[model samples]
Target chain A: MAASASASAARPLAGDSLTIHVSSRPQLAMVSALPRSSPPTWRLGLGRPARLSTRSPHARSVRCLAAGGGLAPEMRATLDKVVASHKVVLFMKGTKDFPQCGFSHTVVQILRSLDVPFETLDVLANEALRQGLKDYSSWPTFPQLYIDGEFFGGCDITVEAYKSGELQETLEKAMCS
Target chain B: MGVTKEDVETAITSSLSPSHLVVTDTSGGCGASYEIEVVSEKFEGKRLLERHRMVNTALAPHMAEIHAVSIKKVLTPAQAQPQPEPAADKAQA
Candidate 1:
């Protein structure tokens, strides 16, 4: 065991174990579902995707739910960029119109009633994304809200914020700029 | 199977040692949903978001089995005392 350990230790750079996910998978199904161009390069640790960042008028943020957790290093960067793209982003169980979960629906209603122009990503559509979000936010629940690139909270918090008019205040701040 | 109200209370009590706790089985007959109200000294100076996060972390072991968790309220003992909300709170609204 010691001999093997020493032999492997001699292997330089092989033990980085950074868990980098250069998704050379060519055809990521989730990207295809997106309305606009979501070139894999944007997530390929490149600046070209930053160009997609500026070019994304409205469609990108709505569908920009990247996977997290085990395959998160690259996905995390992508998610950061995605969250930054929108003033209000909701990572929920379903879209704005039809929410699969009650908690998600409640959040949707709150956002709608508040008249906050937000984007929603249905987590049910992607297994990796659904699982990754639990790890990413550490909240372990759906209907997670992000305002101004910061995680706001889940349904209960949103409800509380809405009642306190804090949600309105926060949305105003986010939308103002 | 999902967790019961007792299990949730036990978890929170052991982890946070809250001064007050109320766990409601909002899942009706099922054990999937719960509404939690907790008051802990640990919440002193913490924002509502952090308090809720602490409660959620306490229940992390059972998160997969349990479905929805609505943290109805989280207060420090001082805040939980018999008193009206501060005027500044109303001013924000």
Candidate 2:
């Protein structure tokens, strides 16, 4: 957790990279058709057999997701590429060396304890990126973890995963890949 | 102004409709942090991570003011029944 020498590119939101991403991984989409009476059970479990769908009919429109925290399409594309480039990515409130938030620090400490080589993107340093990520991940908070181009979960999930030895297993697979 | 612990409890109870609930103000004096235990049938088939996510989502509106929230326990009524001791209290490290 040495902050890892700025692995993230310094591209501001001004210059949208002209990269058209054919997303190989499943992107976040709202399951609006599901009844609100129950918690969305379909979104549970990581890398389940059902997650292999490259295209689901429910994901017809680009705007199927709710109000993005104003994260632009191009910015999301850059993030998608970022998640793909690294086996592990942590978008947190601060750098790993000096994590500004408790939750971010906890997740950083967990990753460090596991001794897996991971990159950190300090959301606090970039406002647009910070807000953009909340929308990009469809998760409202910081310390969002991505293992092998997948949104693993937040601080609590990371802690639970660490305790159950799931995080290690996932990271090991990602590292080998 | 910060949110009270009851506000957090209200949000969670209304959403999860837990059979058992305990909301502790872990912030000492302030209303910024809480330690919660919720046992509900809604969590019957859900994984621990998803259970926590449900709690987090329910409290999303109040999250701006609250500094931290530790969801200590989320279990179904069946899981809660067999336990002799308070699961949430003993489970924390």
Query: Per-residue lDDT tens digits of candidate 1, residues B1-93?
Result: 779889999999999999878788888968998888888999999987888888988998888789888888899989878657453243234
Per residue, candidate 1 scores C-alpha lDDT tens digits across A15-86 of 122121211211133332332322223222321222233333532332222322222333443455546656
Query: Which candidate number would show the highest DockQ if scored against the true structure?
Result: 1
Stretches of candidate 2 off by over 4 Å are: A1-70, B90-93
TM match of model 2 to true structure: 0.71
lDDT of each: 0.66, 0.67
Best-fitting candidate, measured by lDDT? 2
Please report, as a residue range, the 10-residue window in candidate 1 chain A with the lowest summed lDDT. A18-27
| TM agreement with the true structure for every prediction | 0.71, 0.71
